[model samples]
Target: MKINWAEDLRERVHDLAESLGNLFVEGFHYLALFAIGGITAWASVMAFLGMVEKGHISVDDILLLFIYLELGAMVGIYFKTNHMPVRFLIYVAITALTRLLISDVSHHNGPGMGVIYVSAAILLLALSILVVRYASSQFPSEVSAKPRTRRHLVIAQNRAEGDPGES
Candidate 1:
């Protein structure tokens, strides 16, 4: 069998271009994540302080803080795992929608707009959860599937080699 060097070279060049494009896109995503994270962290801190100063750290304010915490955690998770959990974003959206509904309940003239909005938010959250559940059921997390430590790998290798006594 003869290997086509020219075809292989062309394929390699195409692969390199695709990889570079992906890298550029990922870099932009990271930058956007950091920017949004910084802004949310600052806003959360300020809002928390404002609530404290006003002596009104209500349930809604606490929920807002939870949203902020989730946002920060989402950012941290992105940095650690290079992937953001859609679940967190859905939670944030649900909280935001709830907060809006609560704050505007008194002034809303419509009959079921608040209910509709809240229901929509709940539906979105449920859909996100379902998608994540389905994806994970199909492709479980690496943490559950494989040992991440070198020591664990060494132990497994020793066990495979028939060294039962090695602790």
Candidate 2:
């Protein structure tokens, strides 16, 4: 019987390299998400403080806050599920366009072509969100479409084997 030492060493090396690569990618994701989350929080605080100093919340101010909220929610959902909800982005865009429309109207004292264009854009974005939601619901992906972390796999296994342990 021949023991292939060279092949064994090569296989070990490949696996070690792959593990290290995965570790690095995971660490990078954590760092980036933390930074983004922290920035969103800080910006929200600053915006709130600005509104307080101004002594009144304008339409634009409220809309800006809504944008921040949507951003925070997006970051949180991505952190928890690792799935970026496209609807959140569409919500942000809608909020931003509404803000712009409000700003334009207030500045111009009346609606203009810009208002029409912005309104149309917002409507399109809303329709796109509806389409996305309908498509996701009507054509759900395979179970494997979602990335299964070790924790999720363990929970699934527990449920499958009737362990009744931590799910």
Candidate 3:
């Protein structure tokens, strides 16, 4: 195969562009985190004011507040740990679905769609939790099963040494 310098240069340029694009995507992820934080804070404050003005906080409003709180917590955890909890996202989705159901049930029409939507959301939450649980169990945070302590190792060695004689 004849080496084409021009083609090689074109490929290198393409790779550089791709690398820059990936960097931009990561930057946007951080930007989204900030945007989410701002929006959640604003919504929480507005909800609090609405509660004060109404003199009564409905259950739906309380649920919405919880969703916002979960969102804020998720964002905070991401900021601190550089990762968000899937469980928290599932909880938020479930709570939002419940809030929607509560808000819609009292209306005279189309409760079926609300019920179906809520049911789907609950199913998705359940599946997500199951997946996370399975993944955590399969691939635990601890990389090894070995004990790190010299004392434990000595004890295990002694136990192994004595096993043949005892048997």
**Top candidate by TM-score:** 2
Tell me how many clashing residue pairs each candidate has: 0, 0, 0
Write model 2 residue lDDT over 59-78, tens digit each, in one string: 99999989999999999998
Instruction: State model 1's lDDT.
Output: 0.79
Q: Write the per-residue lDDT of candidate 3 for residues 1-167, one digit (tens) a residue.
A: 35698876776687677667868987998899999999999999999999999999898989989998999999999876666688898899889888878788856456676588678878988898999989988987743553244334555687888753221
Q: Which candidate is the best by lDDT?
A: 2
What is the TM-score of candidate 3? Answer: 0.60
lDDT of 2: 0.88
The TM-score-based order of candidates, best leading, equals 2, 1, 3
Task: Give the per-residue lDDT digits (tens) of candidate 1, residues 120-155.
Answer: 877878788889889989998666543234445667
Q: TM-score per candidate, in order?
A: 0.60, 0.81, 0.60
Question: How far does residue 74 in candidate 3 sit from its true spot (Å)?
Answer: 0.6
Q: Candidate 3, after superposition: displacement of residue 54 in Å?
A: 1.7
Note the residue pairs that clash in candidate 1: none
Better of 2 and 3 by lDDT: 2
Error of 3 at 33 (Å): 3.2
